[model samples]
Target: MLANFHQEQSTKSTLVYLTLSIDVARELTHVHLERFLAPLQCLRRLELVIARDAKRQFLDAGQWENFITEYLPRLITFEFKFSSEWRIGQYKLDQFRSPFWLDKRWFIAYDSSRSCLFTVPYFVPTSIKHSFVPVSTNLTTLPIEQHMVFYDRVTELRLQEHLRSLPYRYNHVKTLIIDTSCTYQNIIDLSKVQSLTVDISTLSLSSLMTAIKRSMPCVNYLSLNGSYWELSYMSFTGISLEQVRVLCLSRYANYQGDNTDKWSRLFPHVERLIVSIVSKSQIPLLIDQFKNIVSGFFYIDPPYIEPHNNDPLYVDPSYIDQIHIDAYNQIQVTHEWLMEHVNRFRQSNMDNFTYQINEGDRLSLSLWIGEDDKTAQVVMNSYFKKNIVDSMRTVRSKTENLSSNTTTVITDTSTTTTSATVTTSTVTTSTSSSTSTISTITTTTTTATSTTASTTTSITTTTATTVTTTTTTSTTTTAPYCTTRVTFDDIPGQSSTSGVVPNGYKNLNWTNVLYLNSSTMPTSGYQTAVNSPPFVGYNPGGTIVQITTANGTKFAFNSVIVSSAWRDNLVWSIYGYRSGTNLVYAPFTMSVINQTKISCNACSNWDTIYFTSSGGTPRSGLTGNGTEFAFDDLCISFGY
Candidate 1:
């Protein structure tokens, strides 16, 4: 089986893949691993898990780095597993630093061991070069003199030492994470650490307050995942937090209800807050409390890991827990509530907000805060690089119709109302116009429709048919219309996000456009020169040449989603390129009906237009918070 696996991987040698193993197959040799990896040049992510008793002493980190660099030059994400088995004679980080590269910003040393002071080839944040971590379990803390500039670039820090561990003085941590095991002295003495996470499970509320007052007096950002809201309110009532800016509270489990406004009162000076509000009734109370708050990420459901298998049918659909059913149903009501409440938030000091709504366990809707261009661009790049929709073909939708054949005798039942939409059918068909029909054999006048457009019924005489049917019924019914579209399954360039985005046409007019490389966009030929400065991204961001002002639309490319600040409304926008040097812009005018006079005035010969709104409140459609608009997608339309 191992041999066959390597063979299969070798067959697809040109592809990139990930191998996630808790323990690699013992029988697989160096040759087998090489066979599987040699063919993969575009290995974007690679993760490996090695158990302690495993025969890993023979593995040289330097050798592995050489092998990866020689074969996979495109490896951007390498998640090396760091287990708790940090004894001497293990595969230390020193063995890898000789020729390999490790950037702190690109590395994340997760929970438990994040603060372990690895000595040899130390991954300390010194000189802005090594900004994150270095790993070696064989050693302990080095003398302070040996680590003079170690914590320079360390902007964020997490400390999870046991109560028995000796106190390690940190003079420069800006963000800090400490669990209940740490001594109160350590928490209270950390004057430099600003943002802090206080685990309610470990530390008592009173002790936490004492730590805040004595040590972390200047702490600004506060985040808590554990719950002890009642005690927290009592402990924080008189504590002064005049310098705090952001407050975040997340409920994991056993989250009992609270008065909710206690935090707002305790941290009256907080400018920004992120929370998972358990009760809708508390919203008005919060708005009433902090009137000048900046921004936040809000949701009702506590953060929990989804099960491995996401498909409902795999676990038997009938056995679905009611809790999940409730969560699914709560989304629509909660989302609508948040949207309506956004305008209310605007009345306060909030310039923009993001609403996050999770679409199942997969995708979500988040928009960037358009408060300022720089911050908005940061948020935009974060989300936009992810896949989004262009062609409607990728959309998942459901359709239902009220047919003429579904007619019944008008017994005239009193009245009916429903708070939710109930779906009894899943038949999907596109409709250009809404239509309804009624037909009956009883004493009722009815209009019936077959698959054909129109039909006439004979009642004694054809002329009498119309009159008799018209006289029999006095009531009429209309069917409801709705369109459901699913997005974020695909981002144009990345293959991982672009699922189900087939190139074929959903209709004759629309093509599911996709571009993985720059060569595929603008057809590789018509683009001549870039004239306008890029609006949202780094200079000439990627493979696609941006179509900006007066770069005559020769190949005729169209629209890309850009931040308002990135967009230049002066002359032209970056969407396409000029084809012929004669660069004759086929100027044309488009009139949106009812907004103005439906008239077209020919201007320049330009065929493409790029446009966007500059300022507005954006909701994070993903969580029903404000928008995480930073990660939106843009596309160029050939219009062919």
Candidate 2:
């Protein structure tokens, strides 16, 4: 494609950006890549995903430096990744340390155990699976103190072997998959992991469960992959995982027969289930088992059918026929069979149930059960209230259709007299003759009225008086001032001393912020500019910090206390978002010695808020753009 483009297009040399992903099965090298990119001398940025075996010649930093200098003189950014079947040694590390590579701040790291080499951060994959056993880095241009940058992009980590102490820490991994024991909790931030999959082969389930409850309190989606018989080896006498709302079981992990009760006790609050079942009868059984289950996905496997043993009279017409069981074994499951089972469950449970079935190669049922009785009642009540208001509006609209030529009046001198709206529905009246007072209450109407009253007494003479009262009800609701400040202290089931702010802390979504103890890093501004500390929130250099409502609802942004974490006079560019639109934007400057108050008195109804920092003078011993800042006591308001 590149050669063809060069041959046909005169603007090939004007290319400014390029991305190439080489297939793993293809034998590609630097020579082939050079032939494609060498003509694009004006390219400013290039990304390469190389999946070939790591040859020393291709991995040489000096070769790449020479190639870039000669062929791509305008290239400002270069990112690449190379993986091999065998380890690459450290012989080429010196070449990457030369002034040619160091001048551009392009660093590299190689994992010998995994036989992978990549540019630091830019080419780093976000997901990594590693054996917990110790490994070594055979080559790198990064200093020993800066090795953590190699794993900075990792968000999902898998541990496949036994645990051991490591030199680096992973505080950002939010989805963890483990096959060994849970002893490596200290290596990564447990509170950050919202989804976890456990398939321990030799670890004690009870101990692992205890660790999960004690350390990983934020995990809401859990997958247990062992078979029920294997999982039953450990007693779940006192364990209850109420935090897990979505649960998944591997195809081998069947919760049937005697293990149903045991499994129910373990995940008592599970609202959704994804599991495999051998028969359709198990679907209703599972629904009855987990009374709180609001939805589920059941992969129903066909029953084993014996080959060449078919009797013409024994063929069942309910689900399958003899023709479906030909030598090729193409099976068909009837919709009537599934509906029969579903109706049976509904008849017994008396719940509002819905289902959608896919009759493809893999038969699966997606069920959405009604909410529990209490929740259903609330929903039904809201629906009825809405309909009632709509009906009243319709009546008012119809009443206004009366013609101006039409009039209705009823008068009985012996008793009382009443008047109807002649041309409009805005006014109504009633009067009594025998000294009875007339009261008219006006509510939520567009017109204004005044009351008049008079009385006359004579022989057999009566007087009628009318009184009108006006009542105004306001529908505007004012949200209460935020009583709860995100102090980064006293977080439940987390270390208050130091940690990263989990996504759902205090009902707000946090991004790129760290929880720091005020006393631990006094040299840093995260501690120096504290409000209600011992704890505060900080961001790494050159990163934006974002705070948003977890449920995506608009809330009021009251104020926040902020300070420069690594510099003085840091400029913060603040933006507030409603849905995807920018609603508010402002800029503020901060100092290192004292905390600055950013008050958002006019900022309201924002679903997300984020800030970026730049152009700060670095403090002593600090370096770089000084785009880091610390914050505490964030105040927000919501209606409910």
Candidate 3:
């Protein structure tokens, strides 16, 4: 049966536990026992409850020892239950005699109800010493139940030795909490912790403060609970309040009345101050005391008072302009109050103004008249269309055409109709001595003829005078000439050249001769000089002078050469003007290349000059009113 059971169990993958009857166990011999235990090989954790009757004969001390030594070694956890009649205590003692029984690989829990406490050996290996040593430097979150007994004793000499030997070290510890009682030694050890929370009695305040100063020199958040505030003034006298950036002083009533001044000094670095007030009148006192340091003050009012009170006796939030007070849900009034304070500070022209408002209130902005008010209004209207009004309407002018009578006069040999379309003040006359046709097209027409010779004359004369006269009367449309403004940088000069000359100008030859010199150039105001021998008048815009070599090669001056001794000292200038009655001269500087040549191809109606200095000062030869001269050997292109 045991062999069959083993075969069935081996065939199944599922873990199965069977509690066999004592009668069935007695029927199994040693050979059957091996088969019965064969199915137990696959068990993860096996619990064997030995029946009292089965142990009487089949399972003796020797048999149980043999099974345990050979079969139970592969199980992860083994629990053995002995019956009351089984004399197995002596055998168990012999099993534990082996050194492996004392190893910490397995956790052994015996039935203490049946066994004597003195006789049962509880094994604890020396390797458990690792539990007392520090493994990590960060102590933010630790299992309190596991380390609760060591909190007070953590600073003992032996534990400190173990901590010092830890491989990991911490320079700054954050968010350290000590729930159990702490000794002075423990506080000293925690002096390096930056943020700390502790539940300690009043007696531990000194140690806590000392640890705070040493461990967390710049603690931003400090939450202290328990009866630590009950300490007398003398006991808390040495505490440093400057390092506390945030202090949550819960249960403030427990602090003696005498300690209010001390508590007030603790928040020197606090910018956002949050405090609960028991009475409404205490709010004013709190504000008055810390107004200098606090920029944003939030007060949580007690629920007893009716927040909305129209009575004049009630506290008016307007009185405290800088601070935003919660008086029901009216945010507009608070916004206006904030703006009033901002305007007042702006008016004072202070370097640093404290802007204090409610913690969650959005700042209010205002608009007033300024230089940019018109621009601001346009922008505001674009964003908020309904708030703005258009105040001005556009106006335009109407155009009118006046009709007038016009008469035109034409004196010619041919008879033709004259039209009056001339709209200028000047009269134009076209005289034709020979047979010619004269015609005028305009709005009005008139015709008249005059004969100078008789028709009977037989002389063969090719000249015949035909006088045809027509009058054109019209209104003048020309306006008076206005003098044009001139500037210094508008001087006309020359143009740049590419190496590849054009086809018609490719055969031209040019020289770097002195085209302009300080001697002949204008110094100041406009003047004209006559063209002399060896010097020709070359129109920069029209015809160019061409020079040909003895070898029949045609050459043109590509640039002009100017010589000025005072070139660097003098600011040379050039200009051009319309040569008529209302002359308008625009003076400009001519850019001189190689201290001489000006690209003549680029110049347009330009006259050059050399100034002794800028701002109307003229140079001599270099410094005079003005002078002009004709250019010599100037080049022009004509050949192939």
Candidate 4:
């Protein structure tokens, strides 16, 4: 019987490893089968496993037939054991007297105490052959945990064979859910997968990018859920963005750093960008930074009032619904501004510019790559509408419809007869329950009353107070005034190897912003202040500040002032619209104010100007003996 069982098990697998001796198998009989399998609910759930045998220790065909045809029952699968090895003669004792395997060999013991699967050994298969039965649960994205029905899916693993076997777990998985424990190797081979969600709260951006480079060749969509501040900076060296196109980045409220550069660096070619904007105030800054994006999805979070610098306290969430509505309205205004000024971005020259918007998250004002502005507004406002009108309407109607309504409920116990009453009037809270009526029960028994000798009564009353408030919102627009500041940070990236800015006055410190010429560039990149240095600015050596808008529109302004010295024979000329028409000022007559502020008197309502030495001609008002012509900060005053 022992040889027959071993032979049958051997036929079930390519390799058979035996832990039991021949004597033990021989001692097992039909009478002992139940005792050995007493913990199993049914024989079908038993795994028909055979140990791996690479050392040529398998049984013959004749024994294989005898053992299978006689003792074995119907089984679902063959569980190939992860045993050490099979030696030809390791069992010194008689084969029939071998010890039984210690793990889940023939039975799965149930634990009625906890109503769940008990802890099993690592070597033991927690799930038997019957565990892989196909059911009609129809679940798409399964979240795996350690206990309950949770099962480890595509996560950290040691061997390559385990990775190859993942297809058996799920027939076709398009999306994967991996937690912090997942490594680059674990998900590097999911070839068919198309979308990936990374929780950067735990994993580093470098590790995630490495995995993406190694594995996600076909994946084009990605969503990152974490703080943008965590991504202080990113340099894309090995990351492949040839296929990736869409990204939904949800930076939490606490994130401070700008994610524009990070996103531009890591996924340079991403076409559709979605971001979680905590408040409407960040809209202008976010818009000013990121450019050339095809679509935008701005998910507006609940409004958080900007607390003062030193104030520390927690605020409850019981504020009125109007507060929430105002936040949404602010976002609406920002969205409108974006749509109106969207053409401003196209000024840099685009092919066939058009517009469309859509909802991003269910409540988020996301911009999908599609059309129809009406649909976008509907989707964006859906959440606020539901919460404000439809969802709360039922509760409000219950309280406001009736001036006063009363009902009661009654319960009775044989041991005691008690009476209870409850009354509700005019004022009411926004709370709700199913109970509407209350009744009192009195059992009139002289003998019962005599034995108890007690009287019981209860009374309850609810009073509701209603407070009404009205809020009005107003907005005002004012024209911009004149102000001058210097920081050489603009665009058109370059230098002539001499570290000289265009036209030779400043140096490009890797930033386009204006940085005043100091003869040597500072590493900090922001050392330009008009308040500093021999009156701060530039003679441009020969180059001039030729102002023009990117859209070919006239750069109209009321007054033009140049930071130049007011000295004899040191005069700067100006050219532009004079009194709403294009004109140029002769170098000699230009007004130099206060020896520090040079005024372009003739170039009023100017559209353009070139601050130069007026063809080197000596010209000025009453001034000093020294001749010095230098220009620094340029201020343009515009008003309606």
Model 2 Cα lDDT, one tens digit per residue, 1-640: 5445567777878886677767672455567667778889988667676676655566778789899999998675576777767565566766788987655546677766667777664454567787342223446775453444444446688987655666655655767888776478667878667778887646666777887778887777887776533446256666788878777764422333345556667888887777655544556567667778766665533353222223222223334334432333323334444445554444655444433323333344555565544221101111222232222221101011111132222222223444333223333333432221111111111111111111111111222233435632223223355655788886766674556578788888776566777675555566545667578877643345668899776787666767676666665556677775666555455655545555543356678777666555767653222356777777777642
Higher-ranked by lDDT: 2 or 3? 2
Q: Give the TM-score of each candidate.
A: 0.34, 0.50, 0.25, 0.30
Give me the runs in candidate 1 sitting further than 4 Å from their true place. Answer: 1-122, 125-161, 164-168, 184-189, 232-237, 252-258, 302-640
lDDT of 3: 0.30
TM-score of 1: 0.34
Global Cα lDDT for candidate 2: 0.57
lDDT of 3 by residue, 390-505 (tens): 11101121211111222212222122323222234534433322211211111111110111111110111022233455544433322111112111112234122101111222
Give model 4's TM-score versus the native structure.
Answer: 0.30
TM-score of decoy 3? 0.25
- What Cα-based lDDT does every candidate model obtain? 0.34, 0.57, 0.30, 0.33
Instruction: Sort all candidates by TM-score, best to worst.
Output: 2, 1, 4, 3
Q: Give the per-residue lDDT of model 1 (tens digit) for 443-560.
A: 1111111111212222110011123523522222221111111122333443532122232221111111222221111111001011121111111111111223223232222122
Model 4 lDDT tens row, 1-640:
4324434444433221112222122334433433333322222213222333212222222332244335433321112221213222213212312222111121111122221111111122222212221111121111111111112122211211223222123212345444443443432345544566665466677767677777666556676765432554534565646556666666533454445555566676665556665544444444444443445555544454232223122122222223323423422443345455444333532223233333332334433223322232213533432232222112101111100121222211111323333233223331322111122111121221121111122222222234454432323233343333332333246331112233322211111112243333221111121223323333322223344332233333323223223232233444353333335432322212212233221122344444433221222322111122333344444321
RMSD (CA, Å), each prediction: 26.4, 23.5, 45.5, 41.6
Ranking by lDDT: 2, 1, 4, 3
